[model samples]
Target: MTKNITTTDFSAVKAADKAQSYLFDNFCELLTRVFMALEEEEWATQAAWDIAFGPSVSDADAAWRLVAFQAETVTAVQPLSVDDLLLHRMAGLMSRAVSATGIDALETVRSRAMHCIAQAPMATAAAVRDMAKEALSTIDQMLEHALVCDGDDMSVRALPLAA
Candidate 1:
């Protein structure tokens, strides 16, 4: 398949420069976990949020993360904010995931991803992958059945297409 390939510079990011966005609130944990599967040229921390959120933070999946800020009551997050790291990370992922499917399909996936929430981000990502595979399988089945039926002829084919 033709792909829109991109590359990244896996360099260290300054903590002060990085920022954060709470992706957890928007997407389900499973779909968000897809990041875990991403080759961590740098995505181990910040996702490609820079580009994804630049147009709008809403463009990201259900981001649930802490930023560099102190709360009135308490502060628990390590290093405060990860937005900088996530920014580049997300930008990279989008680059890789962008396909012949076009922006419309990506938008559809983005909308669906929001419903996914957090537990283990990596595992959640895997679950999202599986869900799409399952959906495509069903589509294949319907298409095969339709082909055999044709127009008003419900005759069974000698060869099994499903196999």
Candidate 2:
């Protein structure tokens, strides 16, 4: 279960300060979890490792408390693969969208993800296509939360941004 701040002070200013502190801590924990999950991915890089372990959690393995990641031990280097690149890029764009990507950029990503999903059953591997579809679906959920679009020309307006 999640634990919240405990306080006895009832002053308005003190309560606001406590609330801000709680929110900041919650935000950091969420952000840290995101990076740690990235560090567990098949395409995880040095950057991901640094981001995940560079904070208070200095030593991260495949397991953290009850959370465990399936070990991916493929060290063999293979030839270049565009599908891998495209899939990772799309995942990165979807998962690490911390700020408003603006309506236009989000639309472009949606279009690209859709095209990748629509390619013939012969094009990219089914796994890549499936992951792309999942990422696009997640982005659509995010758009539903933050953007309102006109059905006519797909024009969008931000909803005062999410906090």
Candidate 3:
């Protein structure tokens, strides 16, 4: 079972805080850049990595964590393939991320997410009743990073559900 945060568990809290900081600082910026580069047809794997991780390249561990998060939240949603056009793949991924938020008007969401990646307060919180609440909660949660525990591992996870 996952342990709840307690004052005595300083290391766990510290790790969670560090993870949150990294997600806040780099994750959003990287997504914005990725979408922008895609729109311009100027995105390259190497270039994206350079731009996103260049400042902290010496921190190999941090870079790897960011890359793993990227894979989970970005590329894994809509992957580039040998036969796929760059623009389409990019749009697919962005759209998928937005849709995962359970928002209506997927095209509009996609357009906005791609064009305005850094916009915040992407979702509104409301009181939901019964089963609907359970469904909507998942959607709402997608917009922000959450520290999740799975067995012995803990990771910061988020999706492009944020504007």
List candidate 3 segments past 4 Å from native. Answer: 1-7, 35-39, 42-163
User: What's the TM for model 2?
Assistant: 0.37
Clash pairs, candidate 3, are none
User: What is the lDDT, from 0 to 100, of the residue 65 in candidate 2?
Assistant: 19
Task: For each candidate in the order shown, give its overall lDDT on alpha carbons.
Answer: 0.29, 0.42, 0.34
lDDT digits (tens) for residues 14-73 of candidate 2 = 765565444333323433443454344213333454355543342332322112111111
- Better structure of 1 and 3 per TM-score: 3
User: Taking the tens digit of each residue's C-alpha lDDT, what string does model 1 give over 21-70?
Assistant: 23322122223333322222124124544334441232221221111011
Error of 2 at 31 (Å): 14
For model 2, the local distance difference test gives 0.42
Please provide TM-scores, in order, for all candidate models, with all chains considered together. Answer: 0.21, 0.37, 0.27
What TM-score does candidate 3 get on C-alpha atoms? 0.27
**Residue by residue across 33-52, what tens digits does model 3's lDDT show?**
43443333222233454345
Q: Lowest lDDT 10-mer window, candidate 1?
A: 64-73
